[model samples]
Target: MEKPRKTAIFSQVPTLEEPRIDANILIRLLQVAIDRDFEAAEVALLKTLIQDPCLNFQAVADKTGYQMYYLRGQVGPRLWADFTEVFGRSYGAEIGKRNFGDFIHCFLEKLSLMPNSFLQQDLEQHQIAQIFEPGEGEWAIAPSESWFYGRSKELDSLGKLLSQYRLVTLIGDVGVGKTALAARWTERFGAKSFDRVIWKSIAHAPEPDILLNELLQEFEVKELPQKLSEKMSVLMQIIKRQRCLIVLDSAESLIRTTAITALDPYTSPDYGRMIRFFAEEPHQSSLLFISRRRFNDVLRLSRANRAAATMRLEGLQPKEAQRIFEAHGLKNSSDWQRLIQIYAGNPQYLISISEYIQTVFSGSVQEFLRCDTVIVPDIVCQEYITQIQEINAEHRALLFHLAALKDPVHFDQLVVNLATSMKSQSALIKALNDLTEMNLVEKQQNNAILFGLNPIVKKVILSFPFIGGS
Candidate 1:
């Protein structure tokens, strides 16, 4: 699989490869107020508009206003009638009562700030001013629109986890769609039930003290006591009263190709304090810990042993993959199967390749079946990898090799190839197990280890100049 020619096009000086979008396509994001339950959609729409005012289209604004006034939160048919009247054009039958969800989705999508050369020629060239830059919305209630595709089961599982326990551990690898699942769950379930949902990514492994301080900041509490014990006391008191759902992302120190380094310094004793705070304090609270590492590191503290439900995401199924393509407006049953065979259910990779085939490659879904192209490792994966500073060169090198091999390799084969990298067999097993927990790889009975290789990943890997590039 060679890297997608599109990536190469992007790499070349922009003047060299043509851009795909117009310069003046910055229509404001739709701000149709919805039932308060749809807060996530409203906030996201508002932020998109504020950040990319160039997308502010008069027609879109009018429709959004109508939605705020009349239609239920999601897009509906009446909006279509308004669209025809305002824009002098109408598409999609029965506009008065069509799915507002789809309309709002398409509307918001068109507002993306894609600054490409091709787009420049299509529209006008004006800068999106930063004076009113958007801020990160409160813990994400709605998963990004991509999750709206085909993942109902995963979202259902998440709702169950939330119902059973206060602490949930969303364990999955890069691009496995853990965050998306949580977002969907929070939107559908939280909107109807929970009092509040707070999303906080523990950016990196900083000293426990510094990390704890930031956690307190999320609560808007200033001037903490210097003594660790006092701060811990204050934190617990505040948490006990609120019915809040907390997501602590990347709680461990398992660095990967996509994780960023943090600046936290927790002494062994303080580490105990930190663990106790999460596990023992906040007796009536619920929390979720999302990370790439397996449970051993988190569970080792003993505090987490009595709490926390776990949800590990897997690759998509063929049916779900097909559903995603259809939602994206593709209608080829045969090609859908081909896509599943190639991508093996990795959502981000699937979406990336799909985008390439659509907007960049002339909208022919079949082109993907006929060609081999590598895409970026997904924004999620790339962001996760940048957080790892402790993953040294040797371990990283071993992972690179392991990623190259097909899964279910016997332990003997792995050791023959990677034993030299580690000091002993125990260490190797731990390392491999860590990857498994990360959802980056899998292991099974009979001492066999498997690596993550969905169709899109394999395609991307093969596209690279080197072998096993994914």
Candidate 2:
């Protein structure tokens, strides 16, 4: 007999009480996966995914026994709507509200991540807290007093540039401490030269009105201006009266949509006008921008000159990372160097993995180094996979191969080997370039580039059942 026709009215509605995995359950399931308790996380993921109790989102949580947080990264309006309809709020709400969007208009203003956030509920909590609550510690500064190690020259260079221009742009990869260095200097010493220090983070692009309101509220302004122009004029007047230092944290603030409508007042020009008029053009005032990329590449800040002083925050020098270890009372230079190489100078990685090493090895860096395993945790690798996916597929393939190999293999031999499976030599080189740009691979002094997949990245790749067996 034919199956009975399905009727909408006959369908059983799912509820939070139904033991069906809702967004809340799905997200928590994802967290357990990246927490890398594979034995535990897998059991939970399988139960949540294998028999989904019928949800719209497919079993993307499977494909690999990794976090569902890596959503093949559609990150478009459709996904946002789909998740919101099912989950009752944007993914940001599950993570934290204040950092992400609230409703219409001011949507997706920021696209940054908490370093290795998928695995850490604490970081997620901190960002989500910002959604509804206005926060004071919005700006990050490397405390000069406690700024134990790394990048002294970069700091001095930043100081010199600020001495010349009223505004300076600090750009680098995530976890490079751009905000820390900026705030540390200003809070420690810049206050004497620059009368006042004000820090603001544009994590989610706020409306000019909202931002202005916050500034007024923070400064305890008695009167407010109605129009933006009038407001900037008044704000500029106030800023001018006091020698001020302003840190516009997060590079996202510099952007306006490429498709903004004519009626929209939040044009690139309006934003630029406000910054230049209120902050940059004000008398004896200095402004600093901390961002992931050179803000100009992504967003056109109103009048921020192409010639404005720029600093590309580089990785922690080997010696600097060593000091970080030594400060923690870890001896053994060779073992420490190996650990730094595993983290590759990103402060978050260095700090985290080093802490782990200390906890396990108790300053005996050699004990931590004894295991040939790359020191990175499974979660960090999983966290970076979306970024890894953005790399050229051919290069990603090479990366997977290197990951499987585990021990560093000779460059030419490996290239020749991977090339046989790829389309051509050109394809191999292009793939290498992609991996290089993503910092998954590095070239040795002899020009032999190797896939230095941060230990965690290597481990995750190797754990994939079919990595190089294909």
Candidate 3:
């Protein structure tokens, strides 16, 4: 009798019509099978395979910008072993570059035949494992804490607010440590309190659609919708099921300071809608918005809903401000309190002032104070100038008038001071409210309500050439 011919590894499995699987679906399958995430190169290879299954290793390397040797040697062998452990040896036997798509299609078809509960359970378990893994889920795109000092009360307050509310807005002046506080809180309690911690800064002013798409991808959504409405719905579903803490820093970039409207036209309406949904919808997640000025919608929603809250961050306490001076190696501890008071305990201003003292006054706080003039750093001045430019001419005039004040003045006094520049009392009141919202003017409630600029802010305004003498 003739010897029976051995069947080839690729020929043993019956060929089925290759179904077109979404790249994201294939990526999810691969992630599940391997019990881990893919590096950029591996993900690129898989995405490329969806377009052309018959491409060789060289072709994949050319498209993906990965070396052919790296793909064929290190990547190929590891994938083969990983697939073999998940699928049987027959399915994993001949998974080369040319037949990679065939393998994926066959595996997916087999997966479709498996019980739905089994697949769901596996996926759930995988996600749970990822969540519980130590130091796993923090995506800290915000700046790190260089030298964080006391905010014990604020930190505790944040914890309590996050527990009770789904949306919390941390509003403050430009350099009042809002970003630092958010970052530090995330560093301390993020892993323990939530499944994932995501930090994003919109300082560059990304479009709402682009931002939503990026966030959906971050959550590993299998299919993203083309419409913003659908995307918000899907995101709400994910947050409802999974405990998440998301921080949007530099939120003022999207808000309008000149008007009571929550956002400027540069930002899409969808962004505001998304914020409303997060605030209104019941979910087990928290969205923290850090902005210099509070949004009108946030204010409105916060009043109506217990799930939304806003915290107006102020300058650090005298004790906390002392630490910054100490870290800068400044002398004259006796005068530290005076220095802190002058700077209003603003962390960034203190840090900049401390460094200036260290550089110019030989680390002597007394010497720096003796100069008897508010020393606004260039960076801080530029920030103030930028903010001033965004406001209307009436608001700018009001700020300049405030800068000229010898002491906090009453509302009536402001009207008289700005009578020529602003003829309408309602417009003057509106301007004061806008400036207060921007944290540029401080409100003092003594026998009467009085408004004045922080010494540092007044100094910056007076020194600013364009508006100095106006």
Candidate 4:
């Protein structure tokens, strides 16, 4: 008996001998808001097609030294389907007819018309102004909108976390409204929930000493603690005595991605000691951390382990997205529903796109949908793209593999697929766990416990250039 061969799904395509468009240009085009690491197999195939658009699957298969059966049956269909979904066209048919270069030209031309491109062009010609001033007071941090739609149910759960847990973390992807929700929660119940409320933003990555001193100043401690240990003791005493509620925005700064060991405290030893003491020791006060990524130290102490608590935010419900659309004074159409789905109900993304449509397409959701392009504004795109690109290469590659699966996969399947790329089992598990922590991958609720990439994440991964020449 012989074992079955398993070639990579994207490796069937050959590298381009002479590309029509600059490979770098194509690469830049694919790097959207949800950018991920390039896939080698796909990149090779794409490069080949860019050089010789008329080459069919058989030619690609021959060039790559892969069986035509494997290339055509497994790789070609998935590739075509992904292109169709992203480009909103019969991309596969165009490729077959050797009109791929023409399609690329037209797509790039339309991309230039998008609002994001306008910003990009300006950025290329000018320097951006820095506007991230240190935030002060709960009022300064709170959502400016007088009315917040949706999140009623989330508020209830949040209330529970605040009441029961010593430490609570609000985690979500960029622009998922974590800060708005945190600020609103604090503003609504600040006085009643605790004796004192304090808000601070770590957006500028302040040092642990600076953060501690600022809080101490707020506490009006006449005698400052000279040592880190003494500072933690003093902080704990204040928290217990005053029943304070501390809100730390962008808490991901405390995370040390360069840590030598997983068990080690977060990058800032002082901050790590502070959170540990807050979670472990008895105290009347609570701390709320809002961040795009969850820190290992925080999770270790979360209520799941009978220590702290965490709330992971998802996109808004359809009705909530509708509120955004209505706010923008846009009329509803069938395309409205699809638009919401395409952006995964991200509030910031919805607002940005709605404004883009209003300003550029005369508030016509139908016209925008007919164009069939993912049009995330430069501001929101930069936010998400930075977060995605920050992940280490190995973990990122794991995510790319998950995205390529296109279906729910079991742990064993992932292990086998990952091993084919020569990743160690332990490393593979670590990468998978990292993805889980970021909420990029979800485990099915069923007992079987299959895993799959979130739909929006998958779309972003597919949008990246599949070619490597760039």
Candidate 5:
């Protein structure tokens, strides 16, 4: 015996008494949400998808007489893909009938009221209110402050990115304020925009499994996924459920020193995969990467996607640097300008000098400038020295030559200057590229790729006794 054929005449319809609204209204809203062409059959299919008490696609296919192939392959994917595009993430598995009710509920509540809307109830304000308050997952976020300055532009830019993009990398030299900027921005814009803000600092570049397990714990996942891919999927599911802001500070700790200049993925395999997953997957959440160096994979992705971006923090402006001086009660505002120029307005350097003046010179800005020809915080100088020692002698020589130059030099000029003393043009180019990535050398604004050393970096190099004093 064969099974009997089912037709639209036999399809079941429900009244308002059974549920909240007519199935037709839901089908119309969904069509508007997805911006799709729905014929009578597709409408019937959607009615089954939403109104069926079982919430089972396969069972509905059997009862409605529509081929499972069309329902599963053609209509289902289109609907979900549109949802992901509109909502910026997926709420359920790609193939499953699970989460249908939650999806309906969220859409009904979250979406703007459409014309001819027949919603029985609007979205609850409590759901929107919950995102602004700190939740269980906020233990990892850093505290915000009131004294942060000169980063309003950066904060606004990050605000736009978090709304539109999934991954953002904040790159700068150490003490250039990457961490502070990220933390401050989170407090200003992120605190209200996201439901959970989790901050983690990579102290020693732990293995992927360890980090993954830790993150799962933070999410309070009781039954952890066995595989890395499964873990990523589960994490993304949580992101879809609630707005999340994940801040990973000191991201450069995970990249091998030698690999920093290489045009390859980050040296840490697990972290590399994480970056790729964040960039490629659809999620409403944003990941903030604060690092001294840029991840090549992230740079590549950001270049290709406006939704992913990199914000390279530079030195503070003169007016902004003045606040640091005033906070220390330092006098001689004009002399402070000279110090700012020498340090290129780096807050760490200014603070260190201010403390030194307060203790030894009675906050005399002139006396501080008179004694220090190469002014920098001792810690910053040590860091610069360490970074310089990482490269070979040829790269070191190129950096010395760059520091010695009065203005930015073109590649050909650089080659000519180093013809007898330095390595070949290719080696010099490679070294220059490496130095630029490390934030020691910067390209000048010209059609030709002219390169120059950072002012503070040059001062530090000149101050090296063995390198011949300025």
Candidate 6:
């Protein structure tokens, strides 16, 4: 069998060399034009266009392993919308894939003709959109906000915090949307507000030396420092010069818990030093550290330095939480508010529980709530288990005792309950404070301050093996 030769779409155009274009810039333009993050398929299609400006959809499928049908049907229209958005209606009016090559060529030539200053001026005037250039680090694409609800007030508070402090720690429980909020804020204001923006995740607990090297490289530093101290010095210099917004996510991974004691809480020493440097050093850049718990070093530094601050993220409001259920196609029930309240308005939990309800109760919220017991989704429970295991036994015992209680209790009640396990009242108070800081416990102020566990947290604790499974 003889295969037909594939033809170049650009062959019909004039014989001129293709203009070189930075793919990252093109990708960012598409993202901003469409006001959403590009999915894997969309990214693949763009890469294919950039790699071979003359290739048709058939050739693109061969090169990128996407179905030609999908390239034309699903990916094509969306991309054309982005094109229409970035270019004009004329550029995207045609539906033929053949025009893709022309689009690329035209876009590249247009980019070349514009001066850098003109582009900046246009960006500032909001005539043309631009985003932060990728710096040295793992630059994560900001997640889509299609289903993101609420946090308007938090966003405003975050902006004020960044303006006032050089280092801001966003503390929240697992699945409480800390990372989402940070990414959203950065997406909204990072380019306009700072010279450079970099996102790094310590989810794998990368050592301080490795993290520093990665950050330094993001700034295009060619001469690598061999010593940690030297790396810190070089990074401080770069940050002082360039107004950078560096986000370190999953920062709780940097805290060491193996040797944690009632009196002495331990954080990774190098990580602590780096945090202290960011908190204490005079720099134009800002660092946003997102963690499940407030690091002891951050606590101490925040007390002494006005340049450091911490914001604890709570769950969505009732109305906002209802949107999750509505989006999930769950039936409206009077108990929807009850469900949201029990879950502490946590988006991840609500999403997970909604799926459970869909499968187990046919998407009937009332039916799901009929069981009367708070059903902590397995995924949520697993996350709680991982976090609880990392805390000291004293903290765990305090949590367990709180979980056993029927209602919120005062501090004096907790002191009496855990007196035998804890050495002194001071130790018990510290445990309460630490747990509260971690977002694992809640503090309610009425006639007097009362402490309690979130419903989900209490449910998880009751099921613990040591607690003999409620």
Scored by TM-score, the top model is: 6
**Off by more than 4 A, model 4:** 1-147, 258-261, 303-307, 401-417, 420-422, 442-470
- How many residue pairs clash in all the candidates, one count each? 55, 9, 0, 9, 0, 1
Off by over 4 Å in 5: 1-138, 143-147, 259-263, 403-408, 417-423, 445-450, 459-470
By lDDT rank, best first, the candidates go 3, 6, 5, 4, 2, 1
State which candidate, 3 or 5, has the greater lDDT: 3
Clashing pairs in 6: 136-218
Sliding window of 10 residues with minimal summed lDDT for model 6 = 3-12
As a whole number from 0 to 100, the lDDT of residue 16 in candidate 2 is: 26
Prediction 1 TM-score vs. true: 0.60
Q: Report model 6's TM-score to 2 decimal places.
A: 0.69
Candidate 4 residue lDDT tens string, 1-470: 32212111121222233334565445433433113333555555666665555444555656777655575576555554444345432221223222344444434433333344333442210111111111232222232222245988877788789888888899987667787677657656766788777777787778777778788887878888777777777888888887888888888766654344366636666677777778989988888899877766777776346578778988899998888777566665656888878877788778777767866676789888878677656665455455567666666667778877858998888888877653688877776676777667777867797988766666566665241011
Residue 410 lDDT in model 5? 89
- List, residue by residue over 282-319, the lDDT tens digit for candidate 3: 88999998888887777788788676899988888888
Task: Encode model 6's per-residue lDDT on 1-470: one tens digit a residue.
Answer: 32212211121222226455456556655565555677788888888776654444555676789887798689978877655555444232232343455455544444444555544432321233222222244243333222357899999999888878889999988887887788778766877788887777777888788999899987879989999999999999998988888888888777665454333443456776777888899999899889987866666777886768999898999988987777556786677998888888888788778767765676788988788778777867887888788777777878888888899999888878888889999888877877887788999998999999988889888887553222
Worst 10 residues of 2 by lDDT: 96-105
lDDT of each: 0.49, 0.51, 0.73, 0.63, 0.67, 0.72
User: Judged by lDDT against the true structure, how good is candidate 1?
Assistant: 0.49
**Ranked candidates (TM-score, high to low):** 6, 3, 5, 4, 1, 2
- Which scores better on lDDT, 2 or 3? 3
How does residue 318 of candidate 5 score in lDDT?
87
451 Cα displacement, candidate 5 (Å):
3.5
TM-score between candidate 2 and the true structure: 0.50
Once fitted onto the true fold, the runs of candidate 6 whose alpha carbons sit more than 4 angstroms away are 1-140, 143-146, 258-266, 466-470
| TM-scores, one per candidate | 0.60, 0.50, 0.69, 0.63, 0.64, 0.69
How much is 6 displaced in model 2, in angstroms?
72
lDDT of 5 by residue, 1-470 (tens): 32212112112223323555466756654554444557665775767766643333444566678765687678777765655455423221222333344355434433322222322333232332222233444433353322345878877877887788899888988677777677767645665899887877774677777777777777899999889888888888988888888888878777765543464445557777888887788888888888887777877888787557887888789888888777667778889888887777777777667766765676788887788666667778888887776556677778889898889998889889999766588778777877787888988776777888876788888888353322
> In candidate 4, which residue pairs clash?
10-41, 16-47, 16-48, 18-51, 42-466, 43-466, 43-467, 302-308, 303-308
